[model samples]
Target: MNQQTNSEAKEFGSLLLDVGVYLLSSGASCSRIRITMRRLAIAYNYSPHISIAPKSISLALNDEADNALFSGMRTTPAQGVNFKTISGISRLSWNASENDLSVQQVRDELSRLIALPHYPRLVILLFVSVAGSAFCFTFGGTLLEMIITFGATFCGLFMRQEAIKHKFNPYICVYIGALVASLFAGAFVKAGLNINFEHAFATSVLYLIPGVPLINCFTDLIDGNILNGVVRGINALMFALAIALGLLSAMLIYNLK
Candidate 1:
């Protein structure tokens, strides 16, 4: 095996690992991350081994021609899925398989995909507010309750985004979101808004639920990824706890009982 060939194998291995870690941190299920990464390695004619954990991923690659081994690990940064980004990565993997693209070409394609823009802040806020209103309606809330819930959800999500912009701890941001939402609910009731107070209060905070983590917990469990499932479940529970604490504090302060 020539040194140049071995070096290229190592470089490809590292890049493959990076792609897998990005997917994992971006809220892709563990199974998907594993499958997509393995498929990419297979396309490149390399034997790939991967280990995924809650916060990190490790990968090893073996080059048959050079009889060389390359291994790398990347700690995943906290990131949420932009569906467009995930779709782009999926397409890139498919293209690499069908086209048998070289490592450099694959890297260029990945660079372009990764640069795709995310949804604007206003769009996210509007959608989340609508979702919160939907949840309230599904819970049999009155029209007035839904209106107050929408306003509370909007303001809560706005606070969350601001906190994120300032790089606050994520859990802290969740806490603030719940606090603001619940406080608004309390204020509406205090002002004698014609609403179902309990329903509005509960639904206002619904936007802060960690829906992805809760769904992924069951997914990982059913897939026999027990450790990851347990971890995700615990993370979801912590978020729920933070939300409860925040809402409780607000209720107490506003004499909402």
Candidate 2:
């Protein structure tokens, strides 16, 4: 009975961490969220992978830039609390039964959510409009293409918003952003609009900063978890590749005309 209860607690703690991750990524309104998980084990108190341990639910919120993923880790020993020896057979629980805190899980969930076609539909449409404006400018339709690009770029700031929402696959987002920018550039060029590709490209690419995961990877290495670090680095690299592919696809389509 006790073992089952502890197991349930760990699962619950994991869930809380997941939610915390989402809030942090969402850039909603947070400065930061502080969290701690407490558990007691019979033989061993913890594992490195679990975000929180049963005995110490008193940990503070860590930052993305800090690389605290595996860095600055310290083991909380089970014994000597209240003068009693602790065991490896652990029992775990949480303070708040309501808030979610599962960071990594939520990252994956957000990816799945954004991957849906509907989310990109409007974003893509706005991009097309910008492209048309550029096409007009190239062909001497109007000088207003510059104004259109400015407005479109401003609204697209939500790209950063999504990043905060824990869209770990930043490369895909960059690709889409590039596709939008390139569409405009190609259109302007094709239409003989007087516009600089460099400006459009620079304006839209700010959405590609995969900052948090990169920090996590660095932190993992600092914490002596090289394997975890390498894995995260690979994921970052793949995201970068996705961005490149998005750009390549857009360019290829542009050249076809």
Candidate 3:
């Protein structure tokens, strides 16, 4: 029975580590990752120590004997936000804490949650176009410019998605998206489709802003996760730079000034 219990505990800790890695890779803040892992460990009668960095997560679990019974670390690539996955994992942690589910049972629930489908690609594209069009209107774009911005943003998002799907670097994808949007807006101006160049150009690339990363950077700092906060902040800055470079490149190429 002791051997069986130890085996179960080890399996539980390993699963918990995987959960932390998944959360980190899926864009959860460092504080959120640590808190969720600790909560899950408490639920399973283990003590957890978790560490999160920009690209990796480490978890160490202790059994009743206070021995380091399990330790795991994983490196994950940067991934786009998926609030559904984050919220599902949060609910799973809370449920596990409340219901006293066995390790295998928790694993099953986690698998089911992870399998939940994401929003369809078409829906995401529609939302992105709508957001860009809304920004254009807010920035004083004429109706023609707003319509053009919408179309440009839609096509730009498609290009960005294709680049990402083809395994291009994220920075390159952002640059490409910005370039596509700016060129489209510039072409419209050159062709006399719209004259309010400022509004069109400004709003055209707004969809590429790294809003989540910037927000998470501040949140991490406020929560005292300095290293992770700095990493996120730098990433946000790099993304902004890539976008600016792309926009400027488009302007020079198209002679938009």
**Per-residue lDDT of candidate 3, residues 1-257 (tens digit):** 36776677778877887788778777888888888989999877788878887888888888756777778778874567777778988998998899888778878887887778878999988899999999998887778888888988998899999999998989999999999999898888888763788888889899999988899999999999999999999999999998999889989998877
Candidates sorted by lDDT, best first: 1, 3, 2
Q: Where in model 2 is the C-alpha error above 4 Å?
A: 1-174
Residue 62 error, candidate 1, Å:
1.1
Please provide TM-scores, in order, for all candidate models, with all chains considered together.
0.95, 0.42, 0.95
* Model 1 worst lDDT run, 10 consecutive residues: 77-86
lDDT of 2 by residue, 118-166 (tens): 3364674466456545644554444554554544344443453454356
The all-Cα superposition gives candidate 1 an RMSD in Å to the true structure of 1.5
Candidate 1 local lDDT, 89-129, one digit each (tens) = 88889998998888998888878877778789899898999
